[model samples]
Target: MAAATASSPLNLLGFNRKPIFHCKLSSPRCRPTFLMPPGRVPSNSIARTGRTFSNPPSYVLTCLVIPPPPKRQKPKAIIQFIGGAFIGAVPEVTYSYLLEMLAMEGYLVICVPYNVTFDHAEITRRVSERFSSCLDSILGSGLPDLGLSALEVSDLPLYSVGHSNGALLQTLTGSYFSERIPKANVIISYNNRPASEAVPYFKQLGLVVSQMLPVAATFPVNSVVEVASGNAWKLLLDTAETVVPNYDLKAFGSFMTRFTDQLPLIINELAEGISEFKPTPPENLESIRELYNVQSTLLVKFDSDTIDETDQLEETLKPRIETFGGKLEKAVLSGNHITPCLQELRWEVGNVYTPADALGQVLKNVSVNDTRRLATTITNWLDLLSH
Candidate 1:
């Protein structure tokens, strides 16, 4: 203390010269400004990993668990994502990036692969139970690879986010799961019309033509094509390469089966649900209302989505929902039907997360930006719901 250097603070009567100089140097102008737009939150704050499990009642479901940012505040809510018809049980076409973005905004995201054959509400109920059983284990395990850690989960709100056929399933499942209203319901590109009304005339004609073919009727063509990944199937694919345009032998097999065999069953079930005089409807609007009140629902319509029946559904739901002091909100986003599903997907295998084509040339015009925009729109809508 005999001699204090100029770099060191001069402490006299609790005063320090070096500390005063440091304060003067650090002024408001020296601070960096975040010039990006308010809603453009970075998604790197989240982490995700795929999961598969066999729940009770003989059901197999795949899910991607997206946990919140590390060492930050825990997610305030949970979102159960259901994929649409033909969407695989993987990151392939489920808008994985958008799910990650939602996780970044402080929500535990559970993305479950959907199949057209399964009973929607029943599968949802089973999956919900499975999640409830393993949630505590997932949180307590502290799996850094999965970006998950133990956190308080009591009384956390739950949300259901679905697209296309998945959206309709969620509507029915929403009622099946609980009597209370959800924190929010986000429906994207909702297809409410039955297969008869939804399919194009030419496509419907194509189905008829495909069904008449002896090759399609013989053998379990759809089943083989669906799981056509082994050496034998590859040999079959090569032999029929000229006949079928796609790898799945879709032109020769599954294409017809999907439209002809699978679609009608789904349509019939929905029709029964809507019919006023049906003795036993699978799930009707009145039955849904009795099960649960969807107080706050958000319907997102893609501007170029010709297959969208969101408006029609909204019109039907508004009067019924409003009767119980509920609300329905709509947002028309830009892009076509598949934009929300495959925006961030790559055409080539094993290169997940890389936007396949760049500079205005590709199989589809959907972009990573579309995914971001949808994510931003959803977050903004959720913010409004909270208020």
Candidate 2:
């Protein structure tokens, strides 16, 4: 048997010594001491001691300890939306239309902003950070006081929606602050891929790593890495769409035509950019993927004309749909992506709907199972907020 070296013990009773160990110790000096005043006790001559004393009551030296108060209950719900790329170029008309629709049906919605002008890496970073901050704001800002008679009160459901790059932000929101937000009733994502498939591909090359192994060791494959790459791809696609001419022309035209009258409002909102926006990426991929288990529905609308390959888009989204146990609520309207945002759709593009009507449908749909109902829920909620 090989004897253990003095410095590195091999075994003790067949048990190898651990490389590191920890222990806890208490110091006598740290103990508190109580001393009575010299004059409080009478002098004693029996043992030639300066003073004699009786034992003090234990209660006299004990201090009362109070526990901290419990945390307050959070709001009933929180609604957040992620804005697409393009500085201040949110689908405002659609958003407003949806908000008003939801407000009418009694729900609160929050529109989140993301930095689309910056590089992809920067945008991803900002999306995560902004989401965290926005959640903090919503938690801090008490629920919006919707003035309604008690008789008309109802348990307003909370939901979130995101379009284009905004979908990434919504993913981050669900991943990072699920606990702080209300149970998401619906998550309507428009024209975007899942974050796991959109983030990582944003950069031209994968992230570099430095290690001390004899042969360079790489970081273990993780969900974050995969999700980041996917997110990157989505961002790249969005960037290309914005600059590439003739890309989704019909949808672009529809968005422009419908909101052309609200250009000033759109421009003003864009002017502020991410100054009023907050949301951040999730701490890890598992957190974001957990959103699939949430009881929320997702609707993905594509303009068949603008999308050269509809099958490709469907394939890309298939996994996400299955993961969430959700069916892809799709609309293949005659108009391009922009058609859903136009007034012709009666703003139903941004709001939820029950019957799943065409662009000309009115805002009369009202069943949760119906597309029109979802639309009404969104429109009514938006109407509750002024401006």
Candidate 3:
């Protein structure tokens, strides 16, 4: 007769709040649960072989290693990753995460650090040489430093993934090694504009700096200026703080040194490479196509990436690729030039009551992370082409 309480078994309508259950099936149905999609990788299961520096100091190579998953029964294919201009194999953790994704998917990946020499031809040649040596070391002699004894690299198909200028280098490598290695190449953010076009002031600055202090030209002084002027390391540092907070700061000195030492060489190479995109005779275009006879090529361009030259490049090369019975696939994605490699950060304010809320969005605008979706897109493309 007492007033009903919230926890009372009977409801206001005089019926029990909890409903009785009736089982239709004699036994409960069992359904399968999968932690991840079939054939996809679990992050924690991936293994890594630490970076092994190329012997003989002048070679100046660092092998960025990402071995395959342990449980896979069959041998894995290889992917050679070439970093963008001024970014060597070990510049940042973002690069590491991207490579790890490939490795996690059961692919053995070798990352060639950025070459100081801007000459794409020379860089391609050096990369090819080192790639062969690295392959041999893994298969036959077994380089102890690379933990190659654990891998079986014999006769496996090789593919290439290059970013920015490294994509240019990959193109050259594909052309040069068409017969021997690399079945195809995946080029990201391929920009073919002249270096001066991209940075008009860089040419003038280089000219003035050369006259004012030629000695500094050889000493990588320009690199120091860029860092101090907040042109180079600002975004990198900010991104690292949010995405990879414990990343070592000292590594920046080595990275900057490498970048600064070869600034002039890269500028000169850019000039030459960009000019090749100018109007050429039909015969010249035909000859250029002959040089790029790889089995297939995949070009990934960002929808918002204004710096890309792959559109122009594809128009010229597609015919050549088709002539050779090869295929060319172009994919346009969202974001800017760096979107494939760097993720966008979303910053939100805890409350609007404070003045700090106004600054939160501005700070968030500058933050970045490594784009996992980009890596997945590449993996899917590889799968499509692998068959």
Candidate 4:
């Protein structure tokens, strides 16, 4: 499969360009603990290329696929993963320590990315679609570059590992992207709070956006600007789009169009209709009691995570998946909700696995150590389920 592409004429915003991602080893938030080669990111043109409308381009990513360390044997399984809300935008960099550690342990890691939106259930649906699309694209064309090296692709077992919001998503789909994905699910620090809780001033933002939509619509517009706003609006409203961290795009076109001030609110109504709802509204969470599907689930709770709703997940998902002959178990790990978001590069003291892993025993941060333990526990559960 060529990976779907859409062509559009130049719009007023002119962000018509493909997106590229960059990560630095020295960044405190980037992965550097494992010795791994540069990642091979497949092309996902959420934005077009060759059209510069004077606006800085934003990338809404489809997905990122990473091969295990070459020194390791062929990948044992495909670990389909997603991280939390904001940090998930940089899954490769944010969760590199644990994800690459899984790769180091000989599993191909497919990290799914999604831009944040208030429509929480819709996020899961879009994530499911994008994840499946990414898998198909990999099987269709990128296997060689993905480093499969003669391993049987179709026969590999699939497991899902998620932290925080990622866990909430996997809970809904059961991470059921393919037949390869088993009934077993691994959920860490699962939370399904209202948009008002996850996003500060959520109701206020929605209210402000609603009030400004009409006023913003009355701002000046030209024929060229009107045509361009449609494209710009679509890009802004695309919930599945993933982006690189930073880019430089100016926000000025003809002085005639002044919608920039109300862009956030205006785009919401354009994309989501004028109605405002929280992410995983009460109705969505209420639906989970009967809507969840799975066979076996491993729920993880952190020692100090106050915001986590593992108890709620257990109360809801345990019965749902179990009704279908599934089992649910829980583990308490030492860390907060943000443990998975912590990144570190270990300095090798002796012979380390990769240049990234420092050798010998060193004083590791408690958070790094906790994350390492979390990775170990999930992989252990995966190994057990594989049998």
Question: After superposing candidate 4, which stretches have Cα over 4 Å from the reference?
Answer: 1-61, 145-151, 175-182, 211-281, 345-364
Backbone clashes per model, in order? Answer: 0, 65, 3, 14
The 10 consecutive residues of candidate 4 with the worst lDDT sum are: 1-10
Please provide, for model 3 over 127-232, each residue's C-alpha lDDT reduced to its tens digit, 9 standing for 90 to 100. 7776654554445433344344423344356778888777777776666664445766788888655545655765565555556554654666565655653556
| Per-model TM-score on C-alpha atoms | 0.58, 0.37, 0.64, 0.64
What's the lDDT for candidate 1? 0.52
Global lDDT of each model?
Answer: 0.52, 0.34, 0.55, 0.57
| TM-score, structure 4 vs. true | 0.64
**Candidate 1 off by > 4 Å:** 1-62, 91-93, 118-151, 179-181, 198-227, 231-292, 345-366
Model 1 residue 365 CA deviation in Å: 10
- Candidate 2 residue 138 C-alpha distance from true site, Å: 4.5
**Model 3 per-residue lDDT at 384:** 56
Candidate order by lDDT, highest to lowest? 4, 3, 1, 2
Error of 4 at 278 (Å): 5.9
| Residue 250 lDDT in candidate 2 | 32
Give lDDT tens digits, candidate 2, residues 1-387.
111111111121332222111111143322222332211111121111110112111100111001111121222233545545552233333443433333334333444443343233445455545443433332332223333221121233344555545554454454444343323323333333333344443222222211222233354434434444355345654664554423343333333332232333323333433222222222323444444333333434433434223334334444654665443333332333332233312123436654545422544222112333336434433332212
Order of candidates by TM-score, top first? 3, 4, 1, 2
The residue-by-residue lDDT of candidate 4 on 70-141, one tens digit each, is: 565467777778888766755644676777667767777777776655556677777777666556544432
